[model samples]
Target: MRSQKLYTSFGILIIFIAIFFLKQNFLGEKYQDEHHYLPTAVFFSKEPIPSLDLLKSYGELNTPVPFILGGWVVSVFGENIQCLRLLTFAVSFALLMIFVWGSPDHSKRFFLCLAGLMIFPNYYLCSVYYYTDIFAMIGVLAGVVAYIRKAHGWGMLFFIGAVASRQYMLAFPAAIVAYECLELLKKGFSVKQFFTGLLTDKTWLPYALAVLSIVPWVLLWKGPAPAAVMTMQYYDSDKLIQYNFGYVIYSSACLAVYYIIPEVLITRNLRYFIDFPKNHPRLFIGYIILIGALITLFPAKQAYNPYFTWPYLGYVDQLFMTIGITGFFKQIVFGLLMLITMMRFFSPYFNLTSCVVLINILLLGKAQLSWDKYSLPMIMVLWFLAMFDNHWLFTASNRKQDKLFYH
Candidate 1:
């Protein structure tokens, strides 16, 4: 990471490879849902200044920001989806550069972080399409970069853009708010002291602004998201509150597959299985009891999941089912793996990345649907934290915790 040669050369190689397969079926578009969004973007292109009525529909449960921006680009370059996808690839590439440069130092770990992101199924792999996720993630990664630099205003601005790009993006800013609030509680363990601490700092302003950016949408839609596509996801704008406790467990299992599985593969000590019980006996017992209760109550493949036909359980569950694991057995496997995932990464050293992951998971639990790509932001933050070697999960046991990881 110190020298640009390796980084630049790798990026070039990737672009060259993508170009080689640009016209082939290697990266097929069967699952990609550009039809849902391209029309909305086209609408934005023709009507650069959309009216209030137009804003009401708001492009298949999306905010107007990305479509408007995408429309502007498409108008200038013609509606070549391939060209637009190239632009998305460039945006993802820019995010990679930001992560590499915005890291506290240019350690080899920074390069590792870049490599991890490039290979992620949801990151660079999805960049060769005319989708809006790449736009949202840049806002997220850039905001995290601002957090690293302690630039409150920049973080707020970036997060505001993120929220406009995708409503779920509120999680990043909200995590900062939660982390700051928790840090304030650490200063004085009282309600009055915590409230005073919150008011006493300029750190919360940016996140506050970013979170509040959703207020107008909430008011207009009369719910968290647009009503135009609510029914498709088995929701009603009139009554958006659907209490599905099962989703929390299902999403945890997905997190285990996406973040925990990769990390465990990297650090294959086998001590996770052996020492977890020995190190934290009571927690282990409680984990077993809790897993038993949860599996009985809220297993995977929920009735409320609109994507029941879709492989929303993620890769691990799909693999299990493919290999003759299904029903109660699959849920039990998810329960056990999820506990290991939660305990391993978020134990004694819960920091910024931990805050991001927990908050995102909790928020997703309430979402109308869940997918592996929803975990992309969390995975990205984990990689960033890994770059700085900031927590116990990243082999930072001997090193002192970095100040950037506080709370």
Candidate 2:
């Protein structure tokens, strides 16, 4: 049975890779962040790192590792656009392998999680685009998996790589530290014990290394200039808070519609939401109503649509964008759900893996832009978290065994 399941997963992976290559060929052009990174890659191909002038001009807009990798590929492969994209595809395939390898063996959840990841629109789009997000995510996912498996040295190494891929990935190591601190507290360790653990525990090495990894980048970065300062001035804290909150809710809603709903429908896994109407029917019905209203009232056209545009998919883009509203009632409902999910962070059943997942979500929510690519890591984390048997938030008792199997 295990052999058959593994074979099936391998077959699915092969099919997914084929489809990804087909999409890349069909799309046939670069857009958005690809433009930014490609130029950097070309420069790096010649220079191998940004000069002081380049750093001062670009002002830490792009990080090093992805561009470095792209440079190597371009050097060997003769500067072909497809070659750079092929590198991204290779990195993405490695990411998929890591997820599969880290997943619980002989479990149907492995297949389901892989399916969720492949079918996610952003993951599909990012897989084809020549960008650094996937490369950074490769390190993030590997680091999280290593931490979960208690491989501290490997986790720290991947975390460093992740930081090198993108500066924003510093959130990941910070999340790890937070998780460890919370764990110590849960174990009834005193302040002295906590400090002692930090000094003594091998697991704590990752946290320290995570801090050290930033030093080189800090020394190299030339810092943002006057224009960047002006840009920051445009979005004040009030506006940023509003934008961030709306993005968090809207992105979560999109995740439900694009990924979660489809998964439930295809698998007939109503058990995934067994607690929804059962535990709070009014809240459940209200959420359903809000979703329906959002769909109905969504604008057909928008001035600022950041979504990937495929042929004949403009309406779908508008539909998803409709969730990007910041009305009082919408905020109230979304805030409620956010609160519930946040509460799960304090649950004793919530393990290190769950803590990491929740922390990533929280940090990503604060990001200014609401791109689908930004949410891909969260989707993968959700898939991995689903593999665990414990119900972090919904468990009736600590000792209760209420596993939600995919099959």
Candidate 3:
């Protein structure tokens, strides 16, 4: 009974903090993508549903769903940024609730999952203003939550909504597709059986439809996004021909440092990362060769944009720079970590988390720049999937899924 009271007190305090954030947001609104977004939403308020031309009217970088939703908020609530910000907070809160609702394990794992949403860097910050990451993440995540819960029809709609909000969200559905196919193959399905499942599987259809949902927007804009906004985002027809391999390295390193290291330390799963190489020397040699080549040829290039002159790639690079680490030495250290991280996922078996995380990472490789926020879709959902699958987080239970950190 006392523990229950303590939990209630904590919940009340969290509510106060949220209220403080709501008020704090109104005090001083900062700039992110919102400067471009707000104007578009203001125009969209009168229209409510955007015409293709209208979506392209603002120099916004991505899809129109967030603005369309923002427009709806403005239309009903009147033209107040404060209203929109508060509503965005509500949307973020709803996302938390939905995630908690859909969690496979409803024990303390539910509360444990909140840490990722509320406390992860720049995660809760999205709710304070009109930043689209939380909104975008929620859409994809709602679909993902629904998908895992076997609600394919709802999953299809939510995923479509997500892709409508942001094109990068395609990664979720694509990862689902790849993971499902790999699962089938692992279960002794032949190539012929795999091809047959694509036709027969209702589960597969939702992802296919979700992927296809991007087609109309592609046709409307003549590209991944509006051509007008593409220029602003440093994307062009020429960019379609090139890949950002630098991001490939940077993102792989991020998976190691940001995602893997935390879980490893918490679970004390360092042994797997250590022993994997010795057990599989041939794979390690191949990985080392690949990393050596990639690092030599296409090392993580620092973003030159004046807004982000942070000396190197995203968070890890920033940390190293703070500690006076830079240049070739930093590259070698990260390369080794990156090698282990990628190998960790690849070894043992095909992992759903690895597939999704790597797919998100690969998808972001096409992005103009990499930021920690770019990783939120994965971070926001990745830990929950781990928790739900009965992985290392909150490992007090007997309901074990796997012996290792990730299967």
Alpha-carbon deviation at 296 in model 3, angstroms: 1.3
- Cα lDDT tens digits, model 3, 1-407, are 34543564467459846776657756566456666677777878878767766865656767777777788988887777777677677777777766655665334444545664566667657877787777778888898888877898999899898888888898888888887777677668788987887677758778878988999888877778777767655566887777877787777787676567777776676776666667778888888998898788877776565444555677677888789877877778779877867775765455677677779877877887766667778777776776565322222333233254533
Q: Of the candidates numbered 1 and 2, which has the greater TM-score value? A: 1
lDDT of 3: 0.72
Q: Residue 257: error of model 1 in Å?
A: 2.2
Clash-forming residue pairs, model 3 = none
Clashing pairs in 1: none
If candidate 1 were superposed on the true structure by all CA atoms, what would the RMSD be?
3.8
Residue-level lDDT of model 2, residues 195-263, one tens digit each, is 888778657667658757877655754231223522443422344343243454545544555555665
RMSD of each: 3.8, 6.0, 3.9
In terms of TM-score, which candidate is strongest?
A: 3
Model 2 gets an lDDT of 0.61
Candidate 2 ranges with C-alpha deviation above 4 Å: 1-9, 24-27, 49-60, 215-219, 222-243, 251-317, 320-348, 389-396, 399-407
Off by over 4 Å in 3: 1-25, 106-110, 305-312, 390-402
- Could you tell which candidate, 1 or 2, scores higher by lDDT? 1
- On a 0 to 100 scale, what is the lDDT of residue 41 in model 1? 72
lDDT against the true structure, per candidate, is 0.70, 0.61, 0.72
| Candidate achieving higher TM-score, 2 or 3 | 3
